[model samples]
Target: MAISDVPPADCPPWLVPVHTLLLGIGVLCWDATYILMTRRALATKSYGMPLLALAVNLSWEMVYVFYVCEAVLETTGFFVWLLLDIGLVYTTIRFGPHDWKDSSPWVGRNIGCILGLLTAVGCVGHYTFAVWWLAEPGRGIGGDKRGKWWQGREGLDTTELAFWSAGLSQLNLSAGSVAMLLVRGHSGGTGYAIWFFRTMGTLFGLILDNAFMWWYWPAGYGFIVSPFAVFIWGTSMACDIVYPFLLWQVRRTELLLPDGRLVRCDSQPASTASSDHGKKKR
Candidate 1:
């Protein structure tokens, strides 16, 4: 019997809790990020995260909560995220258009509608891909992505799929939101709280990556270096590393408007920086 075939009750207590702690905490940080993003959008009437990333994340949560195996700790986390993501979806559709309002109100609404529909399409695609990947045998992986090392019981590897898709989504999110902050050249909706939650997500992401690689990599297979693992985790870590630095650069440029709103430093009048600096020196 393959390790994937191992029943939930048979899983070691220590393993389930540890896995849940690492994965769940990281997920929570991401949830918080989304919540803040939602608030930022409502307050500033601007979008925070890329709709593509948001859509993908919502799909991931939906999949795990509904279709994936029901491990107590893991499924519980997914269930919570599923509930939280509904609000995120609403926020995405609500605020995504305002960013494009200068073009036309219709344009903004169109963009929102398009992204929401595409996200729905993306959910179906994500589910199909996960199901297909899970169906493949967990044979010894080689440099090639699919290895035919063994023919074990047919089953789904939920953890592996989550890391590949959902985890990868998170990796994109860290960098994507920061990129939005830079491009808009404003911190109106995105502030320290957004960055703070993102940082927590990134930190916990690294922990989960390390934990999975060290503890669960190719349980029976002899050191299978799957391409999905390499690409997903590898790319994620690279982006995660750069996220903090981008955040700091964004912070340096933040300014407080006379109306008591915060935006990127460049958005304000030139005197804003000097006045703030002078105040600091006082």
Candidate 2:
């Protein structure tokens, strides 16, 4: 039988705990990210993540929980994230309209339907990709036993699947975050905590995890260290790194409206205007 047909080799006893530890850190970091996002969303009455990025992330988790993931811990992690995503989605639908009220009334009005449609489409798109990728001959089947569990079975390469899909997801998230910050020009629905947790999540989950995997199983995980993977994660890291500085600049110009909306002031510095407005009210 070809190597692909052969049963996966056993995981090294020592590596099992190490594997769990690495993935565990990643999971915790991402879970914290979701929690912080939800909290910030509620506080500002607006959504934190980009709409398209959220849809893709929710769909990715749904697929892994039902169709892709094999390990118990992995499935559990995806499922937990899914539950948190549901809350985040609710926040988006509930408060997203207020943010879009002035710019695009129609979008604010039809936000729920748009998100439903996007989620459905994302599900179909992600599932189709997984089906084709896992079915291809000799694809995604070269790793160790843990590879079979954490990565893929037979030709079902969860790791590579996650890399491409999650890589695209991260790109959308990181780039969209910057775009949102600039477009909004205020600290609405976002904060330093969200950025920090999200950045650390990517660091642990994608960059560090892949690096460790390659160190442990160089031959099996060569694709992870390849140029393509590097580019995807590297671009995301660069975007994340630049986010805080931009946020600082934007915060300086922000004005807190009486109705709890945070907006930018281009005509004058926010501190001067805020103080003047306070004096007038007094």
Candidate 3:
């Protein structure tokens, strides 16, 4: 049989405790770092949209983790997580920065705005479908052949919702990263490191989740393996830990421009000279 046919094992011995520890520790670190960095940024007057973007992202991340661990898997958890997810998508789309004026008209602000709005709409639709499913447990829709909502069976409708949410989340994240990078220009320094790790963690979690689904397909009982679930817990913790360090660095550095954009420095001579001239003119 295919790997998808494999049965899931029991929850791994180290999974729950380790993940719990990581999640808790990460949140504490994230909180401490956020407060410290925010104060520093304000004191230095270097605060800008990027800081706001980071705050929104990290805040939603924390909430997402909380719901995942305490809410999503349970009956009420699903609704809670659904609402939080919707909030995240909306914030990312609405508050996340975009730099259209600097780019070609074809790939400029309008396009990015459209994409962001579409993504938000998609997320809302997915959540709406999920809410509907929850409201009417046995309504035939999508892959829900059995019409049982609480059993967590992967039906067409539920699967579609998962697929859409996952895809939209990725899109939202990518767009936000690109917007930040563009607004900040080249001097992002360790900011790039923060983005890199965050992106990697997200991608890693997604891969593990998809893998678990595949492995648990057919007659398999592999839900116990739960590699994705564990990865998410661990990644969430890592995000919390790294968030503070990155935010601290950002606050310490004079990285915001006068126009309220985050400044990025170029390393190469030509680009550096160009940036220097631009800074001087500004």
Candidate 4:
């Protein structure tokens, strides 16, 4: 059965439309963010997602598509995301080393292998967590049928599972984006478009979606307002909000090369700049 077939038992019929709308906005925006990131990464020849964040995200999607999610719609969404994530992964494997060349040449040299190892580990870790969580009777149910688990015709609380997993993923993505921006000192694969879509996606997907769910179905979603969830999403939101301004400042001192490299224009001499640019192009 599908999510549409089983709205949480406690959710009033009138409320389902709003809940669906909120959820849809979140999902759509997140998909847009993925598209933008992929496009930007290709255009800039830079990996848009942070290495560890992508590893965690890809693993989560892989596990959900394979074992956790059962509904047609949810599974389809996860599958689509997994495909997009593969695109991001390709860009990272292709261009990620360029970003790390100066500061961490060893990492730059072996980025592909390192990412492979991390993703494998992430898949095992996520799968094991899912197995442990679902094996428990009441834990998967999240208290009672009238609670959030009713959203699924099946007893498994895929919603709750997604909540925790996706929350951590969002945190890592947001935090990593900030760190990546500062570490690179230039906007290469990232830009205002990515930032807007990512922030709005998180707002709709994680923040607003959970808030709306808790407002209507408190029993199952009370964790939404709890300290930890608050801290996770809240911190992510702050980082996302702060990123674009930093991007603006960085752009003032950075130049985008025709070949898709970003270089420092403010600190170096024109002769040195020309030489460095030529070498980077080569």
Q: Tell me the whole-model lDDT of each prediction, alpha carbons only.
A: 0.58, 0.74, 0.38, 0.76
Q: 1 or 3, which is superior by TM-score?
A: 1
**Total clashing pairs for each candidate:** 1, 0, 15, 0
Q: Give per-residue CA lDDT, model 1, range 37-127, as digits (tens).
A: 7787667655677667777777777776677645465567667776766666676667666555543677576876777686788689878
Which regions in candidate 2 have their CA more than 4 angstroms from the true location?
1-13, 140-155, 266-282
Query: What tens-digit string does per-residue lDDT give for candidate 4 at 1-282?
Result: 115424565678766567657777877887888888888888888888999999999998999898887767778888988877877888898997877877898999999999999989989988998887676445632344333342343455556667788888899999999998887777777888889988988888777866776687766566677778889998999999899888887777776665767765553447756775522311
Rank list by lDDT: 4, 2, 1, 3
Off by over 4 Å in 3: 1-126, 132-163, 179-184, 187-192, 216-282
Looking at model 4, residue 231 earns an lDDT score of: 93
**10 residues in a row with least lDDT, candidate 2:** 1-10
Can you write out model 3's per-residue Cα lDDT over 5-121, one digit (the tens) per residue?
Answer: 112354344433343343334333333333333333343233222423433343333333432222333224234433433433343333333333344444343443554554455
Tens-digit lDDT track of model 2 for 1-282: 011212225534455456557667878988998998888777766788888889888887888789877667777888999998977899889988877887798989998888888888989998999888777544653554333332334444456677777887898899999999998887777888889989988887777766765676665566677777788888899999999999998877776655555666653346656574421110
Query: How many collisions between residues are there in candidate 2?
Result: 0
> Each candidate's root-mean-square deviation in Å?
5.7, 4.8, 10.1, 3.7
Q: State candidate 3's TM-score.
A: 0.39
Off by over 4 Å in 4: 1-10, 140-155, 266-282
